[model samples]
Target: MLKPEIKVLDVQGQYRIHTEFYRSDTAENTIILVNGSMATTASFAQTVKNLHPHLNVVLYDQPYAGKSKPHNQHQKMLTKELEAQMLLELIEHFSANYLMSFSWGGTAALTALACTPRRIEKAVISSFSPLINGPMRDYLERGRRCLADCNRTQVGNLVNDTLGKHLPSLFKRFNFKHVSSLAEHEYAQMHFHIEQVLTCDQPCLLDTASGIEIPVLFINGAWDEYTSASDAQHFVQSIENSQFVRLENTGHFLDMEHKSASHISKAAMLGFLQPAHAEHLAASR
Candidate 1:
């Protein structure tokens, strides 16, 4: 087992971000694993173990997630633009060459790509769309309301009813139980993160996608209503060098899928991250 080198980054003295770096001496590239909303560096432990041997892997806690402290405790929400800026800083600091983002992290990654396309060599985004449709908006609202009411059961039910139903059978019960049993801080973080998403400018975010110039691979679950395959496919059309892959029987939580499904998702990502593949993608453009 490779033990990570842990550090806390003080971003312009604005936020204290906790990060873990797994360095592979033989690796020629570094990939940063951006977590979804309310997720911590620990959430990507398995992914880190799988990736570090092939490429250097870095994982971090976004503001208000895990050990990362928010800039202002009184103001729990940070806009996606700010998050993107923070991501850029991390990339520059670590000299990371690639990005792999999941769910909400896709928002930040897209924003970063749009604003500064040349910063990354390649990227793989899973289960995310810049456009928030009606069902997704409603889901976010319901989750926010449930969190505000401290209704853990309703929160669990809401998840099970939406994203959970699409998960593998092995994960359904455990997912509900884990969601319903979130720690106090986790609940607060979720509420604020949902609020951030609900209030963000969707069309503006969507417009930014056209500015991306680097090669990108988008993966979506066939049954993900929140960030539907259709939406992700449509979003990819704006990028000049982007490909979309739809995973059958998968949902929003690609990383949390059952063993076989998870392996497929990881394999697809690893294939995309390969140096030869990236070189071919760049040449095709």
Candidate 2:
């Protein structure tokens, strides 16, 4: 219930990254959270609260996003390579023992771990797609046009259309809700993110999956719009020590699945971060 201590760090000498560190009284391991394009540290409010009782948690705003300041207005778009570098820096700075990343953040986490497996003890990556597929590409283009014109209605419509198509049969049976409207500044940030999505030169995660030796848990919504659950399964299969889980009737933005936050995702995270806790849960059940 209390506010987290906000800290700013200068990484790579130029980029000022905004971060929040929450220390747990229980003295459990630390977990770092990497948010998606549309998310900031605020987005993980519920997940942080759920995990804070047992594990220290760290969440940060990516460069130019959230409260983090960019190097300049004309700075180059974010790439997985850059994200990986930043994450490695943070891992060293905080001595993070685990990583929990969502959406594109997963790509960066995977990249960092593949490059340096010992950086963290384990990782939980959800809804991460290394490359955009045809439908996702079309959705991004449509979102770009809508964002350029500042058409909030169109952007909401596009999200609903895409999410509806990906929601499980139970969700499709009910009337869909409109995606939440973004503030002007948030809209601008999203526009910037879409631009990066358009021009991202990062290679597919499968290319680097083999290099990681740590245990990874890949979570995907059974009917996620951006990336297929099958792709997540394939990713898990590629890694000898990785596991996969598909949350039923869920889509992308698993955090939004519950009004407060994602209980399912948090459970998966707990299982990964505290295997003993997970076994305790299993034994109790």
TM-score of each: 0.85, 0.81
Candidate 1 per-residue C-alpha lDDT over 1-285 given as tens digits, one digit per residue, 9 for 90 to 100: 888899888874678788888998978889998888756776676677667677999888876666775533525457678888899889988899899998888888888888764558899988888778988989898889889988989988888788667666656776577678766667876787787777778676568788788889999888788898888877755788888888887888865766665766766787787957545544876
Badly placed stretches (over 4 Å) of model 1 are 69-76, 166-189, 199-202, 275-285
- Tell me the TM-score of model 1: 0.85
Which model scores highest in TM-score?
Answer: 1
Query: Number of backbone collisions per candidate, in order?
Result: 0, 0
Summarize candidate 2's per-residue lDDT along 1-285 as a digit string, tens digits. Answer: 867778889887768889999987875688899987656787677778778867888999887666775433425556667888899999989889888888767767887888764659888888876667777899889988888787877876676678445544443333122234454555566677678768866454577776677888888787685776776766754578888887776787665565433677767778777979877876997
Indicate which candidate wins on lDDT.
1
In angstroms, how far off is 89's CA in candidate 1? 1.1
Clash pairs, candidate 1, are none
Candidate lDDT scores, in order, read 0.79, 0.73
